[model samples]
Target: MTSRKAEEIQHEGASGGWGSVSGMAKVLLREKPTPASLDTLLHQNKPHGFMCTSCAWGKPKHPHKFEFCENGAKSTLWELTSDRCTPDFFAAHTVTELLGWQDYDLEMQGRLTEPMRYDAATDKYLACTWDEAFTGIGATLRTLDPKSVIFYASGKSALEQSYLYGLTARFYGNNNLPDSSNMCHETTSVGLKQVIGSPVGTCVLEDFETCDVILYFGQNPGTNSPRFLHPLQEAVKRGCKILTFNPVREQGLVRFINPQNPMQMLSGHATELSHMYLQVRPGGDIAAMMGMCKHAFALDAARREGGEDGVFDRDFIAQHTSEFDDFAAKVHATTWHDIERESGLTRADLEAAADIYATAKNVIAVYGMGLTQHVHGTQSIGMLVNMLLLGGHIGRDGAGACPVRGHSNVQGQRTVGISEKPELVPLDVLARQFDFEPPRDKGMGTVETCEGILAGTVKGFISLGGNFVRAIPDQEVVETAWSAQAITVYIATKLNRSHLVHGKASYLLPCLARSEDDVQASGSQSVSMEDSFSHIHGSVGKRKPASEHLRSEVAIVAGIAKATLPPNPTWRWDEWTADYGKIRDLIEATYPDQFKDYNARMFDAGGFYRGNPARERDWKTETGKARFTTPTVLSAVGVGDAPGRYHLITMRSNDQFNTTIYGHSDRLRGLEGSRAVLLMNPQDIERDGLHVGDVVSLVGDAGDGAERSVGGLTVTAFNLPSGCVGGYYPEMNPLMPLWYHDVDSKTPAAKGVPVRISAGKKPT
Candidate 1:
């Protein structure tokens, strides 16, 4: 039978309400013409195609005939759709008219076919030649102060493209580089940088197979990273203990049927994933970890008292770690009462989790945005590291901290020197390699970029790819700053809200998608992506270009550099754009030991695994050891108001990844058609005298005396914490105050917004 018919048979056997499958079945079962109708309904299949930009749910390491998730499939279908945004389409519609459309609606319009320039007079966008657009952009940049320009790169760009963009920006004498990492895993980087002297994860994907125990913290692999689910499933089947700690009970964590496995899919057999589940309160991750560590220390002490060596790795601690006395003292000083109250988990639960860790020979701690989007997000990650260090879990088979990255190449971007503060060695090497004195002074991060923009120090923005306006906190302030820019250049595949919030002279430069072949003067090109496991793999596209006029991000950056920068004697932009191998050589030269044969190694099966200091149990610090950070105040919790208001935790739907929505459906939560809904505990609803589907207004201070409120939200009471409310982000981002951010990392406390929920009609 056809794919549609097979999917229908599978969906019937699968659990309740498969939205995408049901939607597909409706189209398939409908009566119409035969082959002709199918041809009309389906988009043209092009060679070198098939890449999903929506979620990071990639195909497995080993190939499968059908390897894609529900969200991934939707993203693929959307990317491969026949819809086209031609020059005539823009000529017919005004920018203002397009601004009125929904985010999903705008993107569904299809890939932009040509370069477009904003027309202030007609309030419309007009077609512009590539050279004209570049020249205009260059002129705007030259007019502005170098510090005024903000170069924002996304994870979608290739290594060559990202390196070129960074080169152009730094060469122009500014480092206001803000990327998608600012929104998702900036806290992880900041946290790990302070503790481990590195920003990326320390483990490889193969480690999962051998891990004795896997502890998941506030991450849902089934939706966020579906490819991870299979490995997790295999681990569970092999009797590896799987533990999950999150406010909500994610379905994927409980059990998942591998869609790619024919036997499993046909037989409807699902593997039980999580052996133990602990629902910790929102923003209480640090407390939970501290509690577990405290219990483990007690157990170790008891074992020592009995004249036997405890489970703790004393040799590793003495050889590879520092500040053990302080770390142990803090844990010993912390009372069980404080841990229970702060974590919202009982002493017994913490003890049980500690017991499991103590028994497991190999353990892997995995976390996501939930642990990194709080007031003390960075501190939370440090606490987790402290826990891992206590048990000597570092640099072993299947043992290390794994921070699941949202985007595909976020790690690779950071790897290729797309950082706010460049490392000393890289900076020195880049200067020597390019024959220019690179800026020794540090530059702007996400928070700093916002501050610069608002202060009018930043006058221009060149976004490689991303919805920077919508993704950042305080939408009103961000949009206002964006509008005030002298020039805002967006190099993207499709339209987003960022394109609508234009500057004085905005230009949208359409580029080829990542899955599309990049055939330049040098021939076909391949981009490298670093997975969460620190494996650097090559992803070459096999699909045809969306449009003939579209250029690769590398070429676009090169073109802009040629227009803007003076001809550099040392670096040749044209040569680098011609072949990505040349860029790899530069990268390898910059970091000699790390990327020895960067080009050749990337082409090897399974790619090259970058060395993580933590993985080697070799602490790269001034003291030459993994220093255990002392927990000064574990009870200093940031919750909502006193006995009345509840804390609002912003989350993403199952069908959504970051700010990119695959569709308007939350399969796990059972919500359909819309994303404007709040989840609360049934007890909280009863105590507050609220009912299901009751319209409520969530009010919070926007700034000054102004209050930002999202009204007309249906309150659906579920199994969430008593005093906590969970809602989707971007929609609920208005409730997050601009000034309210982590002091250390400067990441917005999106998970801990204090709001007074009331029963009434929402104010317009």
Candidate 2:
């Protein structure tokens, strides 16, 4: 057996100590853990089905045997574990004591057994009945100005739960639904709605199979959506041309070994996924995409001058699109020099990518937060749509724009009106259905919500799920704003750091996990989830509840609504909570065209397909056609003063979710036991006079008077681009300044933060 470094060992020994460090070692390494126990555990199911709440990354449950990734398995184990956080347990510890524990240690304390109310006098959480909790919440809500309240939803929530939450909030006289989407994919929804009149992806999972070429930009599905690996592997095996453009050369993109495939698993064979990989700068995605489009347009022009037919989709452009000439002119006017400097890719590379696009008959472009978290996020997406429209790749089989979602059903949640700004149709239907005049005013989004909290305009917060404080940028400011609230309510399954940052009146209501059986008044119920491909699936939880006191999210919302609202003759909150299907019926009535016979459609096949505007080549724009959007050249924000200051791109390890770390192990990056290592290019290391394993401090030149130093980082040189560095997320989130965010999207540009890296002893 080979001796691995302390940083390279994933699993702890019996004494809970990591392995020792060795000499120079390879960077990319993987640990193949045995899955026999996981397979056995998944097979012996209890009732409905098992859903992992830890991460949005999931695979379709297969018959005969179900396969799971390491993180997925860890998530399942955590949910299925025997640990419990009972009321008596909380009585023994003060809020201050619990706040002192690490995030992992808090969750490791186990599942929240019951609803808890913060007792300020005792400085501890006391167990409360669900009815009591709801009554208290309702009283607090009823006293506050409705506009001062924010109903925040997370992606982990079910669509049915989200629908009820929306109704409850609107019925309470406000549409301030500040959800997780506002932080992650608000730009995607905003931009797509403007261009196509729909925010969801135009393609389905099946599209990946038939596409001749798939252009992936800014996402590593291996970590974010591990289930996408199977499709990519199958696509490559069939000779599909897969091209990738990312700041980092993702290990999952280069090669993928399907754990589901018995032969491959037995033989330890991995399939080559990406045929061509281009390393773009952190915020250079827009330029690279635009450059590709420019080259494609030039090619189309040349072919047309030579009297060639079918070079570009002229008929499609003329019939289904507007502003093509202007968009084309802007592309033509863009100088190659500017594109090269901005994108950090040469003209030759852009032409090569263009050549691939031109030759491939069926193409699909997939993007992730890498494209959406930048200042130019919206414009970047529009640019990709422009490229697809130019070649008429969209609205066709195996070709379209796929915005790979981070959380499961995040797209579905948005579809059901979990938005800060309510759509016209949903609002109208909501008003007609409930008989109350819906508020016409646009509500505050995530950024605006934080601003409102800071300005003392927002008074109360009711988050359905998510660790908002940890996930949001400028942690210090977000924490302060949260503390300023009069009341803060968190409806969650387990403990998190967010619970610690409580308000004057705080409540932690425990809810049944998605993988747990919910025997409500109506009967055993099921929730619907929409995947990246627009396929809606029915997920019924089969596991036992973590605790009998844990109420379903729907029930909790109904309880709150009943306590707060006066009895309305038109609506039945009690009846709806008794049965979720009735809520679906209301949803169908709201979007009759999309969800007609909602219950019947769900039982028809795997699930029902939501309306995909691009499938029929229909442009639902205000002009009844797709409009080409042209964005001006924008300058990138410099991180620090120095030129050689490395721009740090914060990313999640394979072993971690957004803010939850299952363990300190990143198999692909060859890091273990610790996540405080910074991956730098060898040239950068030599130029900066640093060596591997050297502890360093990253100093940010905080514009405002604040702490400017983050320390105790171990340096490791790898195959990264020069003047660039990579580190784990959440931990490195502190380095990102509060003001460092995309101008338009307000999304923290976590991928690109300019910092000065110095090698020496860790800061005291």
Candidate 3:
């Protein structure tokens, strides 16, 4: 055993000099310098090979020499690693033994080599052939009520695979398709459509260049979407004002260093990214936005009285919007005292922010999980749209709503019709094309899926690539619900905690990674994906497969479809798998307006932009124009008078992406060797009578009447607000109740979890 001093972890400015370079190098060192590793890194985000599986941010039209970020490199190396998990490896460990392993440890064991079937008697996963696994799954699905079966898609699945998955579900006469988007961006989809007549973003990547002001509300781009930093850094160089409003002062928002720029690396001086950083309280984004709009309305009134041009865009409002009168009246009625109490920012601070927006000619607004994972997430987005519409900072160059996506192909999945509602095109078109009437009934989303699991309505579950057990809220309840299923099928690449929480019958189908070569009867194939800005592009894998037994995601879906379907000519699973170009043909045929000449445009170096009418000044809304909504004023729900109660927010560490953990260290936040630390304000620590490194137990205060608690969490002082605390998720996910969700979108209130922290574990 080695003994040494506890090394203090140093937090640096986001991505510069040796920090980012060393971080990338460290991941490669652990996996050990493989030739394919370098090849995959060079081929990433290039026209010649596959896109980066890390993020959905668009790549430059011309492309860079190294078109990936530190996290991107980590994700690529993780997929291309030489390590393998064979059947022998599983034979040695029981399911009970593997249950004790950490999430990071499970993924680090490397790519799964073959298919597996759970044996409850031995509590072990035994080896099985692909045909046997598919036959069993098919037989089980044939017997169950189609409405009781649910299909789930992960964000990383290619559009070709997602299209087939959706088709298979519809062919089987159910639309129970719940995706990862239901967890992260469901609010963006539901809210944007309600306000702007579109579910996708209105701005492209290039808009970052010309926007004068960018309001980054409730988002941390530095760690979540690092490629966004390039555009932000360039925007700052051009004298654009970047404003941040979040509970914690994230280091990425404070300053950024460009590792690719040699002069900046040599100078060792980081560029200040944000003009102003307001540390709003947890669940305070809605209140802060409302305050800004109220102040802007006041500024407009005062300007008109002085006989000057007012900030209101009267021409644009008259020609392109509805419900302006009612929205304006609500803004006038909101009180300053309520805003200040909820937002944790003074009236003056809101006025200052309003002044910045009033002076700017063009502005862009971007947000992430902070705005979406709330009880009032849909209303929060409406408030954002109301403010932007006040000054006509939309439907023009460098001005629009941009809800930056966290996952690589989440946007792509939605674009290709991975939805609970399959009404992208009319039923007539789908019926004529596929010879089957698609299900018109509304289906389950992530939250509704949890409800289905608990109520015993959903008896069968099939996941394309996500760890559903860990990703969903209400950990204990979800585990029980998942175990109660008759059959559960997971098409995955590696071992996850979800595999351990199995049903009566479980099947683990291993698939090829995005960076690996996928060969079929039609030769090498490339999969298409849409970026956050709605640009659809093709990605071809260049590296060899990790295992000979591993198959492509498309092949697995096709095999299952072939085994299950009732033998119809129109449902040609084999033909679709023969050539993915044929899949593009079907997509284009179904939606001619959006996917015209899909195959031809797919190979274009810059990719093709899927048109957005909202960005082009086209209104397809109910009122034939953008609509302004008068959202209700909701105050921050305090922890009440309880001594140790606090507003707790769940967050992802810099080292992890979603539930996939790459390492134990979070370099950006200076956390290492552990992930169970709670970040709280020093003042809150004093008020609660706790010091650093004190183990505590946390219980939910949502009044759900269900017991929700997490224990063995160590307290750490952070620069958070007085009443706000932070904890890493999946670990803290148990504290979130299943019923605490937005009524409109069914997205869980992840960012607004109210918790009471106390020393020692709870009594049994």
Candidate 4:
């Protein structure tokens, strides 16, 4: 077998060893952030301190001295960098000139110091007062119909800010509250809600303590959530086994050395995580799930035939779940031949995995966007639920389906009713509270928002925080559609490509990052965030603001709401802005069942659990039971093979967060200094008569007739399953057709774009 390596690689011993320490120090030294800002990491992921604002992983009840991970450190340091995007900088560079700069270079220019409005005549963004910018934006918003306005929120938003922002949108007369969740775990929301009648995951951080087995469908913990490694290491110490099904055999899943462990760090001892690691084909999670489930049924019958109690949890399935017969029928109908071909794994491999799964008393199945960003992403989620249901994992202690959310408050944002779909939040309760009729229009999501913009229906766009244009798939479509908007307003901390993709009228409003202190009239207020585990906690910033002009997200949202809408007695914009607790009190009113005693509860040590009804087997669906969902396609993405075509899944580096590129380095994967690279299996590369380091052009087709292509991607040999390839996102994003997405969830099919590789020339 040929060696799997990138052109320029680093030899790191393992994930989160000295390598992680080096990476963290490298970021701190590179950015040269303030010493006070560096010291604030001691408070990261701790009580009465700011949340990491990185991943949605729950903090420990008692965390280590340095609770944050390397990635978390990078995200914070990157945000707190002293480099500033001053008015002088903008004056020196026009929008067109800045647009030509690399994404990393543009953001490295640093944080926006003040509000800026695009000057068409000068082709530059001119500094403007907050009042002037807000007044202009509010006037523009007031002129547009609410349906034409896309109120977008980033996952990093605090629960308070998210609630206020959502309210601001609804108060403006429509539910066009599209957010980062629409692009990410929307399939998880759509899928889990259908099966369990809840959108959030059931497992808490403490659940890892008692869980015997963890199954990672597509989650890469080392990069996605490095703090997650601590739990995995602990679980492994307690004899808990992990099984993974992914195209990439992520080193994090294989081994990890906790930086907090002095002995381990000194000795460089790494803990082995995955007991069984199956390199499932890209977009093959559904087929693999089906095979496991099918084996479960076979084992159950075999045990029953032996005149002993069966391995299956018959009583739990019978009482807690419905449609068992239908689910079993579908599983039985799926042939072993199809499963092996689709999953790229042998029957023996699956049976062995099933054996391990069957022996475990408690198991937690966790997943990331690898399973969600596909054409059949929703169905893939359904298949996972079906497998777990057969084992009666739901509602059991230390066992359930856990969707590993990427963003810190993405789940919290959704919990606060940031959705385009109606019936998610209680509109009547909102109307009763605010004394205004909430519009019932079915609004837009990320994909729908792009379509609306492309069709010239979406005239206004307002984002809380995110690289909106770069984050979503169908980069070509979004880039074209972005200019169709009449107005664009971004409440952000740093500069990014999304700002460069300007509308007819554009405004860039700087906002305070999570680590910065926000002093309101009431006091130095803390923002509350909900983790992926559904735990809500208070986050108090200790570091100074990036700029004096930067406003809190809560203040900005309230300012917009007060400016755009007619003043109602119920809308106490000043009181809410001055004190975020007041906003939490209203959030309690909006979601009394979940957020009761919201102010007091969040202060509880390690915060409070928002409790999923599904965890208690209290079904919120019409059937009043956790239902079994059948899948139409037993594939991660419904794509067929064509000559030279490969399944290209999007990836993130260890040095990068969602959309925020820290640097051009991925230490764990051995690749560095370039994101414009394609990872191909050695066998595939050899078969295609290609050499490592050869530049290639990727032409993508979703059968939408819109052939999208990007050239000059360096091809690197990797240990992926045959016919599977990997590449960094935003770089490979253009190859994914904008129109192609999940049918049920409408999430972009980023994980499995049908791409063909050919010889290409280097970019000038």
Candidate 5:
């Protein structure tokens, strides 16, 4: 037998061992924090400590002494650094010149200490008082039509800040509220809600304990959420089965050593994570799922033919689901040939996976952007739900859907009404509570917001903390759209690419980080945030403000609202901003069932879980039952017409979180000193008449007829599936046209873009 060692050929790392601990220690040392700072950093996710501002995986009910992950340590230390970006730093650099700096360099300049405004004449950001900045922003916004202004939020903000942000936008007579959710999990929300009548996942963290099988459709949990490995480790110890389906063999899913375990750290022994791994092609989740179901469906048919029972869950389908007949018909009609062609998996391989899934009493289907950043992302989510419903796995302990969220409070921000298309119930509640009617007009999401800016319809943009310009697709188009804006305001803690990509009039209003104390009229405030599993908890910052000039996001939102809107008695912006408890009271009054006793319950140990009807086996869909969807195959459309073209999926390096580049090196991928490289299969390289280390230019083929390309990316042979290559995002984002996005959810198809690659230059 030919020995094709997976680990030797491809770069791999058993995540979370001494390496993680050393990395964490280095980050703390580089930040030069005090003993108290180290203490606070270690307790970042504990009961009273501030939440880690990284991924949104829920914290354990009983957290260990050290629950922070490697990335979490980086994120918090990055925020709590002693270095400061004072007004002198801004006065020394021009926006035009600063644009040439790399993202990591820009962020490493440290936290923003004061407000700064763009002076077009001087071409530099001049120091300005908070009042001056807000007044100027308000004046520019007031001059434009309310519909031309868009309010955006980031996932870092607490629920109180996001609530105030929404109210500010609505009271200003605009509904164009967009946020980070649109860029990542909008498909999860849109698809799950259409089928299950809710946007959240049905399973909690405890489900991993009892789940017989864990099916990872696309997520790479090691880099995305390292803390998630603890539970998976525990599950593996119990001999639970883990199946991973992705285009690449992610090392994090293959092997992981718990950094928190002293014995494991001392022994240097790693736990094998995935027992079964499938290299599903990019944009192949739908067909792969269908192929697995095809085998299960056949087994159920044979059992029925033999007059046997219980393989198909007939009772659950009849009582808790609808449209199973149509779903089954479509599943049966999908041939194995098409499945193999689309999924890049043989029928035998899929059947083996299917047998494992079918034999398991309880299974959990966990996925990430790989399944949600495609043209058919919504349909793909429905397919996963259908598979779970087919086996009667849902509504049971350790069995349901789990879409891993990438932001700390992305879900929580949406829960507090940071949506462009705000629901009517919240609108009605706000209208009654605030003595004003919110506009019912459908608003622009993240992509649409950029489109509006490019079209000159949107004149003002306000972000409550995000690198908006770097986060979206079509970098050139976004830059043009941002330059066209009349005013661009950012409430942020640190400087990033978005701060340099200014409009005709721009302002940077410095704000406190999640780890900073927010002193208000009611004393230090504790803000609430909802995790990926719908658990709401209070986050109280341990450190003092990074700077005395810095203000809380709540105060900034109120300041903007007071400056822009006419004074109204019922708006009560002052009262709400002064006391966040009033905001919680309003949230409770708005969503009584979901957030009943919101503030009081949040004081409990480990917080409280906001109940979901789907998890409780209560059908809440339009049909009064969980609806099964018969989705048409859509992966075939991802292929470009041109030959020698490979499908490109932009991804994050292990060192980075979202657009915030922690460093240029990706330690997990074994790349150092630079991120200007592409991972390609050796077969694809030979077929394209190219070699490793050859610089290549990628031209996107999204049927837009516009030429979009990025050059000077070095290609390296990787253990990836054929006809698929990988590129780092925010750099390759220019190749993704604004039009190439999921139709239903409006999320950029960052995971599936057809591209033609060719050699350009040799690496220096």
Candidate 6:
């Protein structure tokens, strides 16, 4: 065990309680002054107010007085802050000069105010008219092949915005649309699609009310989706056991005191969340899942041989599933020795977890990027599905798969049609409705976009929202590709590092935040979004616009589309922007069953379920049944390959969301004033002959012949599985080679970067 006495970094007991209150107030006070700070929280997350612009955790059917979390508070308050980055701020600082600033400092300059164009002569952005900016983008794009244009989407936009953004890409004749999901939950989508015939999870938010056991895998609910704790707290109170498997014993999993509960807050009494927390190896989820599958199969066989009831749901399997025999054989072939070695957990640990799973009447499997961002992320995610399918967890009262998505509407973005790979139904419908041949060629994802940029094929880039450069892995590859592009356009609310890396005809177009009012030609409109539970609802921006010059994302996308296309007869971009309902109607026409009553249902206070076919046991797969698949690999990461090689897991801070850092404090781990730090086992620290505060460098040891290194990371001794280390994301992204990714999903293996420790100095 590591002692906090000598270490500079400090971590407190549990997550939430009075600490959350203090953190919320600190964030609000930092952003807003006097009464305005209090005003910001008044209508937030309310019926007619804006949605919390953080995680995609669904709002309850009946919301509490306080519907926001500490991190959500940071996101909302930051967007509502009075700070603005005007044209003068851009005039004073050159893009080259701003490149020197850290990511935290770059965004701290506040929200962008107007449209700006990049001038190579002065190397500074100057204010330009919206028409002028659009014309430049359209003219440049017209000269290139449609396949060379990349449309990057962010989940921050409303459902209407994302829908139109994708449609616009298809209008220009290309399926090369990639969004944030390609980086995070693409594995969940692909994995579930293959098994249950649906890309989305089958579970709803209310399913937790009657759950018996929740197999939580590699997700930190407290920081990523804090509102999820409400369901977890309710589950614990109702005697539902949560078995958590992770590389580190995160405070979120240990305990969480709801600040809304006055008694729990005043008394400092936190509800214990996890009944059994297993510290698995960094990228050991595949092995851990197989361990449970193996045990369950063995238990069923022995019980059946004794002429007793078996644990497996034989009837459900025979009726609704296929390929069970092959899957079972694969599990039987995997020995306990291999499971124990790869998972970094003993056989007893696996057996104990399996026992809880087998006895539970209703179980829900929940996971996040920790399971998706691995070399074999798709296989690990499929294993979770396999474990649930054995007991017929799908379409049950309280049991199903719950993939906790990262962004506010990442799942919705994919559902509405922002994808590099499009399903044929939508394409057929879109093609028929518009009377144009939709491109059939495979488009580019984030990694593919980078590769294309290097090969001098993809030249133009358009981003709806997000810090694309910082969020992607292989910083060198993306940066090198940026200079080769002919044009880059970013429609955003604030400045990020990606804005500084300009092309010959780069642009920065400011848009309204979700919390701000958006009045089109029709009237003040409400934007809609679909949550992780497939619940679609409207978010009316109650607050005033940050700047008079700012426009809504829906309008910005429509403008770009109209400008790029030569005024086609079938497309009515102007009318869609005037009334977003028309856009939603077109969306319904594209996906009739999913968006049945698109406009009417969006305004409901609790929203309406979009409905998943798999949840109703109506498999849309080619075989008309759920299919079981066996993983091709024993482990997602290699173990004990060389001396001093540690599996480094990149994690997020409590004070941050995705790649956006609000402050220097990481309240969950109790670190302050620095984001560049590495966490290691105390025993490993001793073995490496390093103290708690020693500076070190992580040299990428993937043996890919790529010399990648990240220096100036302070070492902190903490409790974790041996041969595993933890560090903040984006900072450690340099060590992750672009080629080291999942073959199936092409998602970067961010959770496990094999690295060797070396002496380093703090950046001078």
Backbone clashes in model 6, listed as residue pairs: none
Q: RMSDs, each prediction? A: 5.5, 5.4, 3.4, 1.9, 1.8, 2.1
- Model 2 lowest lDDT segment of ten: 15-24
Ten residues in sequence with the least summed lDDT for candidate 4: 1-10
Q: lDDT score of model 4?
A: 0.86
CA shift of 88, model 4, Å: 0.6
Kindly list the per-residue Cα lDDT of model 3 for residues 625-694, writing each as its tens digit.
9999887754433233255567788988778888998887777777777898888777676766776778
lDDT (10s digit) by residue, model 5, range 1-764: 01343345577778889777777777778777556677777677778777888999888878988878989988998899988999998888888999999998898888999999999998999889988987988888889898889898888788888888888888988888888889999998899998988888999988999998988988888789988888988898998889899887887888898877788888979999998889998888888899988899989888889988746688898988999989988987888898998888888988999888888889999999999998788989999999899888889998999999988899988887888886623787788888888988887899889888778888888999999898888888778667878889989999999988888999999999888788989899888888999999888886978899998999999998888898889878789878999989988887899899887888656668889898988876789899999987737234433577778878888778999887765666666766888888876777677767888888887766888888888887777888888889788899887877887988888887888886797656
Off by over 4 Å in 5: 1-7, 634-642
Q: How close is every model to the real structure, measured as TM-score?
A: 0.92, 0.90, 0.97, 0.97, 0.98, 0.97
CA lDDT of each prediction against the hidden true structure: 0.74, 0.74, 0.84, 0.86, 0.85, 0.85
Q: Name the regions of candidate 6 deviating beyond 4 angstroms.
A: 1-12, 33-40, 305-307, 638-640, 761-764
Query: Which candidate number has the best lDDT?
Result: 4
lDDT string, candidate 1, 1-764, tens digits = 11122112111122212443554343234322133323322221111223345444323355444444555545454554556788898888888898888777788678898999999998888899999999999888888888778899897666667877777878888766777777778888788877776777777777887998888898877667765777888899898998788887777787777766667766767787888888888777778888888888888889999998897999888887888898888888888887887788998988898899888888889998878887778778888888778778878878888898877778667777787775522777778788877765667777777777778777888999888878777676667776777888999888888898898999999998766678977899877766666666676665677789999888889888888887778778788889988888887887778788988777555556777876776666667777788765552234434767777878877667666765676766556777778777776776787766778878873235657788878877566666778888788877777666766767788877878786875334
Which segments of model 3 are wrong by more than 4 Å? 1-12, 636-644, 761-764
